[model samples]
Target: MTTEFLSLLCLGLCLSYEDDKENERLSKPSLHAWPSLVAEVKSNVTLKCRAHSQNVTFTLRKVNDSAYQREQSSAGDEAEFPFTDLKPEDAGRYFCAYKTTVSHEWSESSQHVQLVVTDKHNELEAPSMKTVPHVCNPRTAGR
Candidate 1:
C-alpha cells in the first residue's frame, strides 16, 4: 500500500510541473522581427524592432546575459537603436522586445546581425611591390 501511495504522489508532482511549464510558455513574449545589416568602420548601425500591438515598447540586448536596453516608440510600430562608432566588440547577436500594458507586459524577438567593422585601409589591398615594373639588363634580355 505504501508503494501505491508513493506512485500516486509522483504522478501528482509530475502533473504540477507540467502545468507550471505550460504557464511559463503562455506568458512568453513574442518579437515582431529582427533586422540585418552590414556596415563599415566609424559608421552607425541601426537595430530596428517592430511589434504587432499599438501599445508596445522596445528593448535591446546583447547575446550575453547582460540587462536589456529599453526605448520608446512613437507609434509602437518600430524602434531603432543607433550603434555609433561601431567596433568589433559590438559584433554579436542582438534582440528586441516590446511592452503592451502599462504594467509592462512585453513581447520579444531576436536576430543575429554580425557587426563587421571593416577598416577602409584593410579593404584596400597593398600594392605588391614585387609585381611592379622592373628594369631588365640588356645583356640578360639577350640570354
Candidate 2:
C-alpha cells in the first residue's frame, strides 16, 4: 500500500531530525563583567563571554530591551564588549549566546550579569560622621 509506505517514511524522518538535534546541542557560555559589576556614571566596563569552542561569534543583549544588542566574533573562546561613558540608562541585566564556526546552531544564552550604575553627585554620606579642620604638630610621649 503506497499510503502505508508514505506514513512510515514520514515517521522515520521525524525520528532522524530529533536525534540530530539532541546529538548537536551546544553548551551554554558564561557571561561576566570585568573590573566590577557596579559602575559609576561616566565609567567603563567590559562584558566577557566564554564558550567551549574557538572561532565563535558572541552576541550580547539587555534583558527585556529590544533596542540594545551587540555582536562580536572571537578567535579564542572569550569575547569582550566594552561600554564607556556609562549612564543610568545603561544599567540593566544582560546575557550572551554564541555560535561556533562549525555549527549553525547557537548555544543557549549565558547566565544573566547585572550592571548597576550610580551618579557621583548623588552619592550617600554617613549620618553619624563629622569632619573638623585642625593644625597640629606631633609631640613626644613625655611632653
Candidate 3:
C-alpha cells in the first residue's frame, strides 16, 4: 500500500508540471503600436507583435476582416507590420496570434487594440472652431 501511494503521488506531480508547461505554451502574445495609438492621416504607423516563445509565426488581423497578415521570425520573437499613408478607413481594431512551427498549433489570441486616425490639420485647430480659423486670428472668436 505504501509503494502504491508513492507511485500515485509521483504521477500527480508529473501531471501538474505538464499542465503548467502547457499553460505557458498556450499563453498569448502581446500587441503594441509605435509612436502612439492615435495617428494622423497620411502618417506612418507600425504595429508590433511579440511572443514569449521563439521560432514562431506571428499573425496580425483586423477585426471583422477575413484577411490575415503573417510573419515568421527565426532570430527573435517579434514581428512588425507597418502602415504607410494612413487614412480614415484604416482606423479599426486589430489582434495578434502566434503559432509554433513544429507543433503548428496557435496560441490564444491577444487583446484587441484600436487604431484611430484623425486629420493632422484639424487636430491642431481649436476645439471650439466651427469654421476654419483665419490665418491672422488664432482663436475662433473672429470667425
Candidate 4:
C-alpha cells in the first residue's frame, strides 16, 4: 500500500472511534424520583438525573411548562432537583436531558417520569360523628 493510502486509512479509523464515543455520550440519561412517584401535598420530594457520561449538566423539564431547572453533575454523573412543600399544581410529567461540558450539546430527552401529587385528606376515611342528648328545655334559659 502507498504511504498516503495508509495515512488516510488511519485517519478514517480515528474519526470513526471519535464518532462512536460522542454517540455514546449523547445517549439519554436515566431519571428517578425519590420517596415515590406518588406523593402527598406539602411533602418534600427529590428528582434525580443520572448520566452515563462524566462532566455533564443535567436539565429537568416539566411537560408543557416553560421553566426548566439545571444542575451540574457532582462526582461526575448525577444531579438532583429537590421540590419542597409540594403542591397539587406540581404534579405532572417530567423529563431529563444531559449535555457534556466539552460539546455543549444536549442529548435526547429521557423517558417521561410522572409525578402524582395527592392531598393528604384523600388518603383518609371520613370521620364518624355521634349524636348527643339534650338535657335542658328551650324555654328555661329565657327566664
Clashes of each: 3, 0, 0, 0
Please write out the lDDT profile of model 1 over residues 1-80, one tens digit for every residue.
Answer: 99999999999999988666444421233332223366667777777766655655677777675765657764656676
TM-scores, each model vs. reference: 0.54, 0.70, 0.66, 0.67
**Model 3, residue 13: what's the lDDT?**
100
Model 4 reaches what TM-score against the true structure? 0.67
Q: Provide the overall lDDT of each model, using Cα atoms, as 2-decimal numbers.
A: 0.62, 0.89, 0.83, 0.84
In candidate 1, the residue pairs with backbone N, CA or C atoms under 3 Å apart (3 or more residues apart, or in different chains) clash, namely 31-108, 31-109, 57-99
- At residue 32, candidate 4 shows an lDDT of 87
Query: Which residue ranges in model 4 land beyond 4 Å of their true spot?
Result: 1-25, 73-75, 123-143
Please state the error at residue 47 of candidate 4 in Å.
0.5
The TM-score-based order of candidates, best leading, equals 2, 4, 3, 1
List model 4 lDDT by residue over 1-143, tens digit each. 69999999999999998777666658788988998999999998999898888878788999998865555566578888999999999999999998886555788899999999988686565435655887888889778
In candidate 2, which residue pairs get closer than 3 Å at backbone N, Cα or C atoms, i.e. clash?
none
Q: In candidate 1, which residue ranges exceed 4 Å CA deviation?
A: 1-36, 65-68, 123-143
Q: Which stretches of candidate 3 lie above 4 Å from their native place?
A: 1-25, 122-143
Model 2 scores a TM of 0.70
Worst 10 residues of 4 by lDDT: 122-131
In TM-score terms, candidate 3 sits at 0.66
Candidate 3 lDDT score relative to the true structure = 0.83
**Cα deviation in Å at residue 51, candidate 2?**
0.4
